[model samples]
Target: MRRMLTVCAAVAVAGTVVAAPAMAVAGGEAAGSGAAPWMVTVAFKGDEPLVQRESCGGALIAPDRVATAAHCLDHVDPTHLEVHVGGGTLSEDPGKVVPIKGWSVEPGFRLIPSPVDPQDFEKSSAADDVAVIKLARSVFGVPTLPVARTAPAPGSTVDLFGHGLTQAPDPKNPAAALGDQLKHAQLKVLDDGACAAGLASPGLLDGKSVLCTQGAATVCPGDSGGPLVQNGRLVGIVSFGGETAGKQCGEPTVDGFADAAVARSFLTQPRPPLAPMAAADPVITGTKAAGDTLTCEAPKWTIKPEKTEYAWYYNKVDPANGFEFYLPVEGATTPTLKVTDELAGHKLNCGITASTAGGTILQYSDVF
Candidate 1:
């Protein structure tokens, strides 16, 4: 579930050396600092001080939907991972843990090879370094941010946050203790035109999804699933850094996918124009069906059902006024919806919207 690219492979692109300037950064405090309220600290299995620690820069994509890198939760239980939203401290209670019901990692991204010799085909790189987390309960009371489905163009200014950046260096084994810094840095977007140079020159970039510029402050290992906010919208997820295998942050290397092409409508479900989407399956040839007696159904293809809201529209416009929903209702379910007043050829539109408990999401689907 994490971005996997051996240090050696990153130097070669289609077997060609990357021809860019080496990225360097002195490890201390790199980019973001202070208590990032929106920074989510994720832990697994309730281990001592928490088994493993990873900082996922989440923006409360939905009250129940958190977008992070798949690798952040690799080998960790989705249901058991404790999510501390809007805070810097870790959650103490096990019940506060949000169980992840479902998620889809970049289909081809994998670290453990499918076979042996396993080169680029099955590897996890920047190509698909992004993923999302679906929580059992909605993250209410917090304000979720917005996502930019597309990457920011090169030279775009961005901001990032995380729960890691500093650790007491391991003196006995210098390499062991010299981990990543949790904050600080200035970044700009690089062009995808030079992928060979991009990959060859070092820094945390892959040939697949993004192109980042690591400067004074760069993202480190624990910061893997964090968000890269730009122009007030989340444009990318921090996936890698350029520090040498044995070394820590130094030089000016940028993280990968500065301008990630995120899906604008990635969090939405499908809406339908008519209800009873295959009510009697067979349709019974021709009978004056009574709409009132039929059962109503949920929307079809609810992509991020956990982050959606539902409403039935009689025609192409508004059903009523008063309440406009952003969060989802508890009642509806599945591919079928019954018509309140069945008509031979009347058009009924259903509005299915995907949203975060904080009120952010992929997009709203309209059916009629």
Candidate 2:
């Protein structure tokens, strides 16, 4: 239940930031470059291709998209953000480094208290800490990891990857022990409900959006945003972890992960590069009667559209506001729509969306 802020090597007290007392990856061993080729470091812009300023860890979901914890993006200047790829250790020679083009934090993300006071640890929990980072260009060579559509079942074993301290750093010089090489460990998924209940913080590990896990191997500072892989697919992002009874690093503890399954839509939703402009509005043709089929003609676009999507909507008068508003017809997406009895007295309209490398644009047809 320790609300361990795994990303920063410091904790925030009241309104001030202070150095952390400990940060280490106990029971973790060195990870080979092949062990996690898709792994990357969310680091600051530096002179070297692979900088040692590891802020957090992340995995490439697509050539140009990385999945990480939203907290890693907090308060950090976007200009200083960049991704380091193809290196097993931070000091390794030449690797591809890409600047961050953009990023999206999943909605409803909450920041958990760092180094939560033992008395308040059980009550300190956060939600939706996942984020997707857009790289300036696609990374080549390294295979991207696919995101799991669901969380692994309890008792399932998973792999964790990160570049964090392997042992507790000397309090006098914490950064001296910061690990230079990537490390990994095996962990077991725990019953989220039972885990949360033990910590007296059910909302922290709800089993829906947050997953509960534990093992002899524990994540430490610089591990936040790292991937939790189950069956070669990413299932969670390192969110938070803490030892039992306020013990220091390396002790047994339960960790909470931002479930990738719950954030699949946010992670996989298309981000079109540009929008296609319609030369003309869409046109609907057909008899306006029940049982009659209607067709929507798409307008020409400035550029060839890669894809055209269609949708149908019906208008109904609101009794309270006396205003007519459009509601989408369930499961309607084809260019042709059926005028079913369900919409006998309603005014109907169809719309077409044109998607291209330039962008995505939508145009509505005349009411029918």
Candidate 3:
């Protein structure tokens, strides 16, 4: 998938449109049956500017971040990536330009393209197929979309937005245009029968987990790394396309695309790994309820945040093979855990000790 060719390419690929808006071709998974009214405009570093109309594009994932296909950044440098919002057109009033500060894709990305073989058809061809961009400054004048935690289950609907390979009033060669404005398109999920509609180009779809949709979200020479949103959450990045060879934008073989979990795995350094809870001195914030569920609470979680492992001990022992507590509990996610403590009519003492790849954040709770 080449970035300048209406898809993802460098350091590499990755948006959507909106009256509400529509975009096409990205992760091949289904989204919910709703429309995400958002999209973004991008500019390549050292390029003339957004004035060209098709320098780049992306999908909004946060107030200041846009998820994109890493391949699109190839040839170009991050220093040149800029976003524009408000009033819809890429044209600006000088003050409307929003520059990108810092961002990251998976560290395992490859700056080059992957080749296709007639024998085996798999999607894992290139090392660098996806990427993300963080705005250098907080964007104003535009509404952004949210990111989802996982891919939408099968059978859901997906929405897209971008400048597709729309022809000018007069027909011309596909490569004739130096600057092309992105177009908007919508694709409804097709059944298994339609998934394999056009497989002429081996570079596009490899058959597995493909999405079949009607209409054209096809090759737009410049729509890459756009956001695939569902339930108001961004779940996928436009990394690949299913257009025919020499075509600008093509219909997507896969209607929807995304597995949020897969993209998250690319984080070379994840928020330093969420600090896990260590067993604390026992605390029953509330007593057992009539439903036979005991209310349990843990002490405030405190971890210095270093390379380490965590262990919660109950009665001086790791409960449930170092998992479910040996004591009663309630439901909470942090150090002050609150899971229903099924252990009743038993006295318990709990505490924790955390270990890291570097060392351990040590704290022994009192034996309660």
Candidate 4:
């Protein structure tokens, strides 16, 4: 049996609503004066008519790359996917129409099985849902947005922009349709536990790879593949939404997003290498006078080490002796070594060992 998955698109069908949120970029207003320039309206190019068919929303992350939802273009041909940027609305003419030269989908994304269980729907939607489209030629004049490497903390607010419907469909009037104006909404990031609880699914939300938003505003149909901006950075892509009991848009419990950090590898070219760890030797601090406490100061490192060890030793025989011997101080595993009366005339020192992924570094402090 085919399983059903809920996707956040504007298209409507009979029996089931394709699992997308409701119309009018529901609960949002016109993006207005401060609209993002990187916003783009995605559509299909037909053979019969050279017209651009608007489908979803996307953000330009590079001169020739756009980031969107995997589900938006999963079934469509890459050559037919057209990207229109610097537009006020889908109905109005955008600055330029760029043809997609190539595209890539998150490797882990999979189709939801038909007749899917309600409990498992969220898990299916939360999986890799990101995609990147490379344009046929480099786009100039329009500024590209940067992708955020980390997700915003829960309770943080984000702005969503799309060319989806401006109002929810009237249930009584089944003929009501979505709008073509670019709209935007402010939504708060919900805690993973809270989002999962609201959806009645446990362990279904992955905080690192998925973002859940809850509030009066959310993405609706035609809003799929839109950009979720936090601090002016592209942190997520609109993916799916949970339906209400009425099976209509508006007042959704939570809307889902494909995390941009998880999709970073696909959006950028020539990925940078990881830096090596630089660790310094430990130093001895505090008064070294007899009967006073002498402390071993751990060295500062460029990268934090996983583990650290400290060892204290004291000279047990006179240095004048050709065979002077040093012995480990019992119960002195810590960084602090107390100078007792018995060790009044003995030389004391500390040895430090720091371990990291690169390798282990060992150093010793001067005798006190």
Q: Report lDDT per candidate.
A: 0.43, 0.69, 0.42, 0.64
Clash count (model 1, backbone only): 53
The TM-score of candidate 1 is 0.53
lDDT of 4: 0.64
> What is the per-residue lDDT of model 4 for residues 243-297, given as tens digits with 9 covering 90 to 100?
4222334445577788888778766754221111234456778775667888899
Name the better of 3 and 4 by lDDT.
4
Best candidate (score: TM-score) = 2
Candidate 2 accuracy as TM-score? 0.63
How much is the lDDT of residue 235 in candidate 1?
A: 76
How many clashes in each structure? 53, 5, 81, 13
State the local distance difference test value for candidate 1: 0.43
Candidate 1, poorest ten consecutive residues by summed lDDT: 273-282
lDDT of 1 by residue, 31-100 (tens): 3333343445555444455313444545466677766665564433233356666543332321234554
Residue ranges of candidate 2 with Cα displaced over 4 Å? 1-26, 46-52, 112-123, 198-203, 243-247, 272-368
Error of 3 at 136 (Å): 2.1
Model 4 C-alpha RMSD to native: 22.1
**TM-score, candidate number 3:** 0.50
Task: Show where candidate 1 strays beyond 4 Å.
Answer: 1-35, 50-52, 55-57, 74-76, 89-97, 108-124, 167-184, 194-198, 201-208, 243-247, 258-260, 267-368
118-188: candidate 2 lDDT, tens digit per residue:
35644355678777787879998889999999889999898888775544456665555565667777788
